[model samples]
Target: MEFFKTDKIFDFMGKRLPFLGLSSILVIASIIILFTKGLNFGIDFAGGTIVQVKYEQVAPISQIRETLKSTKYANSSITKFGSDEEVVIRITGSSSDLTNDISDEMHKILDSTGKFEIRRVDMVGPKVGGELREKGLMALGLSLIVMLAYVSYRFEWRFAVASILGLAHDVTIALGAIALFNVEVNLDILAAILTLLGYSINDTIIVFDRIRENIQTSKEDELKELINQSVSKTLSRTTLTSLTTLFVVLTLYFFGGEIINGFSFTLLVGIIVGTYSSIFIAATLLVQLKFSIGDFRAKEAEKLKSKREKEKLRAMYEQGTV
Candidate 1:
């Protein structure tokens, strides 16, 4: 069934101003949030302790949190583990020794409250957290470099640069949103952001691939017209892919529980932003990079001239228009 006809509503020329303005506002707001409020880094990034305990029966997280609050480990987070019978506690104390003591005290508290088993106890040092932060940034940088190389080699340098720019745009916007909302940035959130990078790029590559194909086949069309056609042709596929993925993401976001909430929210935002970037940011980037309209126009003019010459010769030979 046809959902909607391909109207030129998103024509780059017509809607460029609005799109650019909105994107600029989003990006700037995100930057301000990042610098001012900053992200609430989780125990995985900040030095803290994680304790996993298994209960003989299911226990309420609120009860666990209250129990820890009553003890010396006042600032603690208690959440369910994989199953109802298991609970995970995270505590961020002032000192490493205090953190460890807090973990031990938590175990004793849970044991006293009910019959439970301590499954795992782990502590992350501030130094270690710093190292993890460095590594995460390095991984992000490497991914961008690799994407730049792959896209540049596959298409053109301009396309490669544009694709990377689009990816950056999505990542920054996602990070900014997270910061603005004061969401915890843990290993999982980092993982989600990285996943978003790859996902957003996939959409971009698809659009770029179509653009490249249009460039090759439609030699007579102007660059702007070719871009419009290319994006329009791929509109259905893009919409279907995004909508199908969003259906699953929305389900997870609504019902995935606290553990996966951040991950799902990140994915949801990424998908929406990714789709938008693929069309406006990435394609508009080509024009911004000075893609040389002259090159495309010259090629089209040559083709037109060749066609006219052939037609004129045919007319002379056939005694037609002269």
Candidate 2:
């Protein structure tokens, strides 16, 4: 359903500099945050024993840490899972044997806290975690390369480059948000990031596709105006799509429990950031890259010129005029 009248064209590109500047600042800040603070890597990547416990009463995280300090499990990371009664503990720099023996040791340690339940325990070796981390990074890198190849093949190298830039912008900010907020970097978060790549690129492609179609069909000579027009026309669709996605993601974030909180959070940020970059970053980039509809027109002209020349040569041959 179209929410806008045909004449209503939002000047999305008019203020690209401010938005681009904002994006640049955010990207740089995110980079700094990533390097300085780093991510909260979970046991899935950092190699640790995860102990999820549900207490009969409110769990004392500080007391639990104090209790572990005397034991081999010192320096365990303890945090609330979902409620005051639920707690998650991570013990890193320990061997897998410790993970297997955690049940006995934890029970002995927390014996004073009566009537509690061990919800779960997970163990990952350092070597395995490192491999997973390496493979995950490889997957992300390969996805970008594949997308570059695909977009270049389908459209032009310029479009591929522009879309990749937009995607990079989305990813950088999303990861930065994750790091800044100290979100757990695990297989789930990695999955969410990969999902984000697809979600973001889909939006970028939509904007780029409209620009391509408009360039081919419209007689508009001004690239900026064409881009503005294209984005304006697709604005409603983009808004609706992003809103619907936000609703679902927001729901998952709020009510899906802590298990998928990081996943939904990534999507939530990705959808908004992706939408913005597609409309502003990607579209504005086309203008900066000197996207010209005249190129297509030139190609068409060349084809017509070649056809006319062929016709003239055929006529001369038919007339036996050499």
Candidate 3:
């Protein structure tokens, strides 16, 4: 479904200065925030114990917290899982017996209230958490390097560079939001960020595809006008796709419970930023890179010339072998 008339055109290039300026401010602010505040690493990246317990009836989170105050898990966090009968407790401790101690203590006190079961327990040592953190960073780096190679091979250098920068912008803003709000960074959230990278590049590729088409099909040499036309053509499609994805993520954020909250929240931030970068940042970068129909034509002509030369060499080489 089209959100706007197909005939309507927007002047994205005309507002490039403002759009770019705003992005610069945001990126700078995000950098500052990241340096000052830092991420709130979860148990997956920070040593801790996580216990999942299921109660026969409603699990009173408040009472559980109050009761645990006198125990070693005084500062523990308690949250309802998928239902009121299920709860997850997260404790920041490096003790090997933490999981068993917590389970035994809960059983000793709350057993009188309702029959419950220990569903699962997770314990990560500080050293293990450090290794995971390093691996996570490596994973992100490898993904970006791979994307850079793919985009460079698929499109022109201009398109490749613009798309990569756009992805960086989207990620930086998303991370900044996480740091600003002190959102928990866990393995699940790392998955969300990786997913966000894929989602973001898909949009950039779509716009880049249109931009390529617009450049070749048009006779005009006005780069800004061509870019504006291309962005306008694809704006409706981009908005529609982002909105549809947002609907699912929003549902997860609101009702998916605490287990996947960080994951869903990361997606929530990434979606909005990704859409903006695809349309404004990535597209505008094309204009800044001074892409033109003449440049595209020259590149195509060069490719054809190179192909003919290769064919001539192959023909000579084959004949010589005989």
Clashes of 3: 0
For model 2, the stretches where C-alpha displacement exceeds 4 angstroms are: 97-99, 300-322
TM-score (C-alpha, index-matched) for candidate 1: 0.77
Write the number of the candidate with greater TM-score, choosing between 1 and 2: 2
Model 1: per-residue lDDT, tens digit, 230-263? 7777777778888999999999988887678888
Which clashing pairs does model 3 show?
Answer: none
Superposed model 3: Cα runs more than 4 Å off: 53-66, 79-87, 95-102, 109-117, 290-293, 309-322
Clashing pairs in 1: none
Q: How many residue pairs clash in each candidate?
A: 0, 0, 0
- CA lDDT, every prediction? 0.80, 0.87, 0.87
Return the lDDT, model 1, position 114. 80
For every model shown, what is its TM-score relative to the native structure?
A: 0.77, 0.91, 0.86
Q: Write the per-residue lDDT of candidate 2 for residues 132-230, one digit (tens) a residue.
A: 999999999999999999999877788898999988999999999999899999999999999889988888888888887887788888888888898
Q: What is the per-residue lDDT of model 3 for residues 77-142, given as tens digits with 9 covering 90 to 100? A: 988888889998888977574655666766786665567898888888888898999999999999
RMSD of 3: 3.0
- Which candidate's TM-score is highest? 2
